[model samples]
Target: MSAPTHTTTSEPFDFARAASLLTDAAARAGAAIMAHYTGGTEIEIKADSSPITNADRDSQAIILEALKVLAPEIPVVSEELASDLTASLGPRFFLIDPLDGTKEFIKKRTDFTINIALVEHGRPCFGLVYAPARSLLALTVADGEAVEATLPPDEAGADLSKLAQTRLRARVADPDGLTAVVSLSHFDPETEAFLSKLNIAERSSAGSAVKFLELARGRADVYPRFGPTMEWDTAAGHAVLEAAGGFAVAADGTKLRYGKTEAGLRNPGFVAWGRKAGASHH
Candidate 1:
């Protein structure tokens, strides 16, 4: 496949501008989520059996509006609005999981996140993952450079005033004693078998895209997923992982690509790692 084309105008993408937009969108989404959260709204099950709440709708609306103003020409495929235009998407688009870990959100676990990615030619070129409850935001571009910011502790939501930024890079561990990050919500037999095949030294469980953020921050070495996921579920996290000197690939030894088919946007099993040998082992 050809490399994905970025959405650039006469000038190159302004990273600062993009980050600013993302931060603002995240803050607005966070506020919307908090309102629903405090109201104790009842949750409904979607057609796929996934839980949805007012938080999901309000957050998605905020994000969609912000992105339209920031990059109006770019098309977006958000989880909340995917069904409306799944069949009409072109080659390049934005894949968004406006509120990931809805289950966690409904349970008030504070592990949910707002995810967005700029996908071109079926690959993510820029990504943003924000955990508003924790005031953590991760952003990355295509060239393996990522940064994280922690917002200040404020009752208001995603306080921009408390932006403490830091560059992120993966830690190189001993190839023999690698660690793996697994999701606390979805663990299947296939993932267990895959883990048994490796000489894993430790295992950690996290919620939503935070697992990927752990790997990107060098706190974890590998993350393997054998169960079903959607393109929006992993696109932003995948871009952040790739930009932090890591890659998420199919268990069959291929780079994980997006925009599979009209039947659905489900993603196959994949592994994410910081080292090439990790991919080989999987």
Candidate 2:
């Protein structure tokens, strides 16, 4: 099935169809990652000191090839291949992180995910996050519509239509207190200070796009990060959150935008809130 090219036509892109197609692609990538997860795989450190394994490359190959058949006209900006990338594509393109949370994966944790997102006009319109280790899949099928499902843990190639999916909606924030999802590996003082200002009743620690999944599922209230992050790292999760009636913004509270060519595709610090913006948001 071919996808409608947003760059060449006036027709509205078929987000639901695209989400289904990409979820399969993400699932295939997940299987490849799981193959490596079970064994002792050699790791190589990137120039930025981030780790990469053969699993990452294998997953990238699978997703990139799948994107070609699914949406040939749309260019993809993927994490494993964008080390020296300094420019954006046209108004529409794909952002892929074949394997997010490498640290968690390396530590034999279950928080890693495969992230895929479509960015149009500087905002993510469609997104998919598949945590293969946990058999959890989350995605945006349309504006204000996101869904989560549990895939068969051992069958990454399982039929998606057979899975039971639950619609996701961010819960309204409680005025008295809130539940915050914090990064398990990258916690810092700035995040601590930010959470201190809010009436936080509890804090849940997680890695990768799982934090966004938590908020999108109404399991958490807010997620904030002051540390550096790349666009591919957050776009898919941001899209899922937005589709579930949530929002993510830069440090100044403006909506987070993609395609940062001048910034080398790096993202500024951002805050994500479920349902509504925080009254005390800066």
Candidate 3:
């Protein structure tokens, strides 16, 4: 039997419904991840020297299965399955990072997360980031409606509405000083230089999408990354941050866009801000 598909229609896509589906998928993936987290899994190195584990594959499989039933027509560009990054990607697609912080996960850190997002015309319209080990779920339920909830990874496909949620909003930067969230595993000299240019009063290091969560939750004012990253690594978090009244941009101050097929889906250095500060800061 053929897999089910969501029929294409002229009617607008229901983001709230889609968010529900994604939340369930993410929760399922989280459960799968925690299984490996507790049982322990072996790691292998990819051609790029990045690490991969069975947990990543298991999570990817669960999410891909859910997405297939959700909207099969929309091609999925996932980190684990993307062998050809230079290939053309149309205006809309689903992006997935089954595991965003492989290094941290291998190190037994709780900062890793599962990321899923819908990119339309190079902008992420919906996104979900779930840190299973942390029991933290952050996502955009609808346009301009972002929230976080406490959800244990063992709960398979739990209904999001039943969980108590905290609305997310990025805090404005303090004129005198800013709190910067930097990469814990991928910190680079350029990121240090970028922070130096700002009147930063505090700094914290975190792994994976957790950095984005900090800004979304008003715990940090900015996140700067000069290291290389793939689209899947940041799209979902970017969507969440944008929904929470924040924005991300390249070093040149232009908006960060997805579907960079020519660039091999690789991202340039970018900065995420709680609020768009003056150009002087960038």
* Candidate number achieving the greatest TM-score relative to the actual structure: 3
In model 3, the Cα lDDT at residue 54 comes to 97
Q: Report every candidate's CA lDDT.
A: 0.79, 0.86, 0.88
Tell me, by lDDT, which candidate is best.
3
lDDT of 3 by residue, 1-282 (tens): 121232343325467777778788888889998888888998999998999999999999989998888887888999999999998777778899999998999888999999999887788878999999999999998777799999888645888878899999998899798999999988989998888888999999999999999999999999999899999999999999999989899988898999999999999999998965564546
Q: Please say which candidate is ahead in TM-score: 1 or 2.
A: 2
- The residue-level lDDT of candidate 1 at 91 comes to 66
User: Residue by residue across 1-282, what tens digits does model 1's lDDT show?
Assistant: 233355454324455566677777787787778777767877899997998988898888888887888778777888888665447567667888988999888888877888998777777768899887887889873346788997522334453335777877877656688788998899889889988887889998878998889888888888999888889999999888888878888889788988876637778889988645444544
Against the true structure, candidate 1 has what lDDT?
Answer: 0.79
Kindly indicate the candidate among 1 and 3 with the higher TM-score.
Answer: 3
Q: Order candidates by lDDT, high to low.
A: 3, 2, 1
TM per candidate comes to 0.89, 0.93, 0.94
Q: In model 2, where do residues sit more than 4 Å from their true spots?
A: 1-11, 153-156, 277-281
By descending TM-score, how would the candidates be arranged? 3, 2, 1
